[model samples]
Target: MRPLASLFKGWFLIRRDLSSSRRLFLTAVSFVLPLALWCLVSYVDWIWHPDIKLQLSSEREGNSTVFTAGDHISPGYYQEMVVATRAENTRLLASTPPPKSSKRANQKLLRQLAPVAISHDWLPYTEAQNDASIYHLWRDIATGTKIPTDPALTPENLDIVKQNWAQLAPLAADFSLASLPETPLLKLIPQGLPANPVYLPAPHEVWRSGWRDFKAVPPEGELSMTQRYQHSLRVILLGFFWACVVGVPIGILCGVFDFFSKLFEPFVDFFRYMPAPTFSTLLVAVLLAGDAPKIALVFIGTVFQMILVVSKTTRLLDPSLLEAAQTLGASPKQMLTRVVIPGILPNLYNDLRILLGWAWTWLVIAELIGVKSGLTEFIETQGRFRNFDRVFPVIILIGVTGFVTDQILSWLHGIIFPWTGRGNPIAQTFFRILFWPFRQISKLSDRAGTPT
Candidate 1:
């Protein structure tokens, strides 16, 4: 109790800095707690799993929706699928078997058991679609040699495997396309575990899906993930660059001069109230599609706010420094350039860091307008198709990109303004390494000059 109390002491002091270790610990917990909550709802049974996640699935004759392993369905819909598939099998047995299916089609149907066999380590994943290995796996399950326990088959499915094998074994002991029976085999019953809805995929499922997507080859003419990442970076940086160029000097002038303030502030304040998106269609019409319109939207969204923020920051600089500079006989331009800009720079840097995040907030909306482009384009496409697992990676990537970029900028801020004494320990160490060669050269020069 004493150790724990000591560990957390001073944690609640207003505006006080926590120790480096404590800050890092809190940062880790911030990320971990959300993941833990996600896991709690995802992996725990009897805990609000409102749908069924299929492990074994089959096609219905008339239905175009072909469910595969990992597909999510409502419990009520799952029941309907079972009833429908079972009725089809009953009809298949009662009526004459339909015309012999192509060997290719039969091989694909046999691969339905591949998920089951792979889970129990009976089938190698690389050979999941291989016919001969899956045929032996079915025989082993039917003859009671290999038992599937982790994801054991439904009792009804076990019966179907035995029935299907009875039909297959007589034609050929091993898998052979030519030796396959003309009559179709019994399809396995659809079975699943209770799960959360499709939108909330399990962590491992997200990881696997994300990994597969990142490594996947895009179809010809589609942008790869790296290209998408670069494009997003380009959009934000370009937008922010133009905003800085046009807005910052005007903002500084507004802060310094009453004439500029009265002339611009009223109109700027009025225009800022109008949401930037309202002008998106107008921008598209004038800019006429492609990247130009998209970049224009981001500029319109960020520039007004940036001007207001920078002007406010500029006005907040201490007045005593300007008084001292005037007493020292500084000229008007000298005071403006040398006093005001330098005094406000640190806070101004902090303000821009925050404003860059605002620029990112506009990225998704900006990308969706005119021509869809960047990572947001991929997210929009995947989300529209209800592939939330694919969408999750892109969303997470954007968040991580923004967060990491801010952290790096913050670290550089501390190193740049060492007198401010504000930066993480890692940044401080990196600052030291950056000047290490110069320090070493100075030490050598001092030694050579000393009497020896």
Candidate 2:
């Protein structure tokens, strides 16, 4: 009891310490909230599937098999078998033959094997069955070898049992099924049966071999993963570059003078209220209307919002600081370069961080329209073909990339403007809330505005 009490006390102390730690807790909560909401919505059978789906892909011979975890599997050219229960009514209407049944004595066994049976209206194997023999063939496909009363059913004897199974001839020819048929099941085979069904393994049971060289192959072209990533990097870099170029100048110009702010205020307000694509459309019409325009439509969409952020931050600069520098006989260029730029810089960098996120969002929108390259384009490509397996990885990659970039930017901001740390609302609010109890306790130690 004493040890447990001590452990509880230690845990409480650790909790208090974490509560007093810093802004990271708040940021963590902010990050976790979205994921929690996503999970909740997904679990609730909302329009969107939660991120719980896992794609199991396997290659056999020249074909591929994909199994989707959870519900809502896609209909593809590939074969599928669903293991589900048939109600009592369904059993009567289906009139499934006992000889044709794969069911064992157990009710659970019956349910398990029901999915592979054939009725007048239902055939559950990978292919359609025109006869009872076909269903019997599927029944012969034992996932496990049966134990015999006479023999121990050793692996060595199992080989002999497998050799006697004639319904498994195709599999024997192709080296798939190895279980023996003891009931003379192959006697039910029709005289002129088509080639035996290709015994395909389940998605988890596929294997691959080394590639072979094919001479004089026809051209089959598609972008590789590396190529796709290269394209994405280029688009991201270009967006960043344009954002810096456009955002910096606008920020600097508005920070320097009151006149420009007055002139740009209404325009900025109008543009800010207007959708980003509206500016994009106008810009596209003016700058990109020409044949073979150098800048893509995506660049225009991504940069406009950044420009507004830069302009807003610039307009928010402290006028008193500028006046002070001017009063000190600092020349116009010197004041502009020395005072205004440095004063507005912390905010400028913060604006850049926010704009970078916006730029990524716009990149997606841009790719939805005219952008030819980037992660957004990759998503669009996947959506076009309904290849959601490929799509999900790209989505996760974009999120990770954005998150990593934001962290890098935050680190760079810390290095560049150490003094501005105290004033950051996110950081200050985070730390203040974290240490609130400590502050309260410290206040109790003070008497009449004096520290004890």
User: 1-452, model 1: which lDDT tens digit per residue?
Assistant: 99988976788889899899989999999999999989987899788899898889988777898888767899999999899889978987888636566666666778889988866556643467878899888899999898887579888989999998888888889888898776777788898889987468778766755776677677678888888889888888898889889888988998888888889888999998998888889988998888777777778888888788888888898888899999999999999999999888898888889988988888778888888898888888878766676788888888898899898888788887877877667877887999999999999999999998
Q: lDDT tens string, model 2, 237-294?
A: 6766765786578656765566765676557666556565555555555555421121
Instruction: Give the top-scoring candidate (TM-score).
Output: 1
Residue pairs in candidate 1 whose N, alpha carbon or C atoms collide under 3 angstroms = none
TM-scores of the candidates in the order shown: 0.77, 0.51
Stretches > 4 Å off in candidate 2: 1-220, 278-298, 371-373, 381-389, 421-452
User: Given candidate 1, what's the lDDT at residue 446?
Assistant: 100
Q: Candidate 1: where are CA atoms >4 Å away?
A: 1-22, 55-71, 96-185, 423-452
The CA lDDT of each predicted structure is 0.83, 0.47
